[model samples]
Target: MMRQFTNQQDLVHAGISYYTTCCLNLKSLYDNRIELKTMFISKEWEDNMWSKNEAGRRFYNLVVSNEFWDGVLYAINSFEPVVDVLRRMGCGRSSMGNIYGELANVKREIAFRFENKEEHYLPVWYHIDCIKDEHMKTPLHLAGYYLNPLFYYQNGNEIEKTEIFRDALLECAHKMYPDQSVQERIVHQLKLYRTASQSFGRARATLMNFDPVSWWELHGSTAKELSTMALRILRLTCGSLAYEQSWIEMVHKKKPSLVQCNKFEESTFVMVNRRIQEKAQMKDRSCTCIPSQ
Candidate 1:
């Protein structure tokens, strides 16, 4: 009996599982193509199968085509970067500060792969550019990068310190601290932070567990105004997966089959708050477990 293929959704769900299965399936086909060809072309099988089935002959032709394998490799290479980023972003501990840099690196890798032959990646490049224009490369993202001490200290020289980025950081500071006098204080504190951070060496033992919010809370006393701004920006959520997860879990738990729309919204709001508190507690626990260097 043959199983009927309905749609793409029936083939794979739209998540990490889908990408994992796709990679596995492509690898299997590429690896077993020789064995499959031998079976298909063998005298007994050919007599019984190829002679009786048009689909089998068509598939054998496809298997022998160089273009088919090229397309498979191209798809795997293109989707691998996207899948890596998606896995990282879906983690519970993922931070907004890290996403912008990672996305930039992925774009660079994709460009490098198709260098000098831009036509090969024109479609992919367009999608990457669209993501940058729509979401990843915004002012808020720059602020996240600016406030992350680890990234700022290590990659500051690499990142283009454009006037726009500086202005965006200052604007973020103003929004967080609306008082004109406080804003001036924040500007001064930021200057002091820049000077001190340059001389401060990060310890290797604590580097992996470093949290910008906790760093500000500890060393931020010297630069209280700037620290507040850092904390605010660093705490911002970079991706929507967690929020979406919360809504999905809420729907599953509530089983709101016949509930009114207004009640559903109210329940979802409460669930979101609970989910946020749980995440905060988890973060605090993880922070405590990190040994002080």
Candidate 2:
């Protein structure tokens, strides 16, 4: 409602002032964007290789748009300028501009500063509150507590993110720590102290947002090319499927000592073929692999 003022120049002036305040920290949105753009360009992030800074520039424009500046101008003329400026944004309680700035601000805060172990993990703990599913959340919790990069292990370059995931999960288990012998046993064997120790010095744990569980593990493996062993053993975990000894079975039975995933992705073709065969036979379109001319 505050945008109707003809003399909104004062609001713009005041807004310019507020944005410049940057928490008394050494960052301003304008300055940070420029620096980050330089960094991204130097690293040649995939997004940047394709018109990178243009998007960031547009965001800067939004924050400093004339309409926005005018609203800010008008706001300064009033006693409660913050309220008026918010109204002009017309976003009710949810301003995209606010979110954009907040995310940018946070990214700047934790971007490269993981030097202090406890301090580094403080931000991630806030993010973990956002997770809701246990079947998956369990792995994530383990990884966070493990605090090590979920990507690297003692394994060779042939490593997959799963082993890292297992280690994190093992670490998380110790942290939550049910009093049961089973929980204690798993934690003891996983070497939690050692893993968390390594993570303190490396940047890997921070990179994956400290979670080893990824969407790749979420969807059952797609069959393409993998070892014959993978083809024989990949098992899909039905989300609704619940069991008592499930973890034990998965870890001891289906888990190939050296293989790296839920295994179903590597070996799901036979099941798909069987279903296709059944459906085709139901119709006259039964299976046929005739070469096309």
| Poorly placed runs, candidate 2 (over 4 Å) | 1-179, 196-211, 214-293
What lDDT would each prediction earn against the true structure? 0.62, 0.33
RMSD of each: 8.2, 23.1
Cα lDDT tens digits for candidate 2, 95-158: 2112222222333344333334555435553553342233333444324322222323322133
Q: What tens digits encode model 1's per-residue C-alpha lDDT throughout 188-253?
A: 877766555432333323445767777777667767777777887778765334425545565756
- TM-score, every prediction: 0.66, 0.19
Q: In lDDT terms, how accurate is model 1?
A: 0.62
Q: Give the poorly placed runs of model 1, Cα more than 4 Å off.
A: 1-24, 27-51, 112-123, 154-160, 193-221, 240-293
Supply candidate 1's per-residue lDDT for 254.
Answer: 67
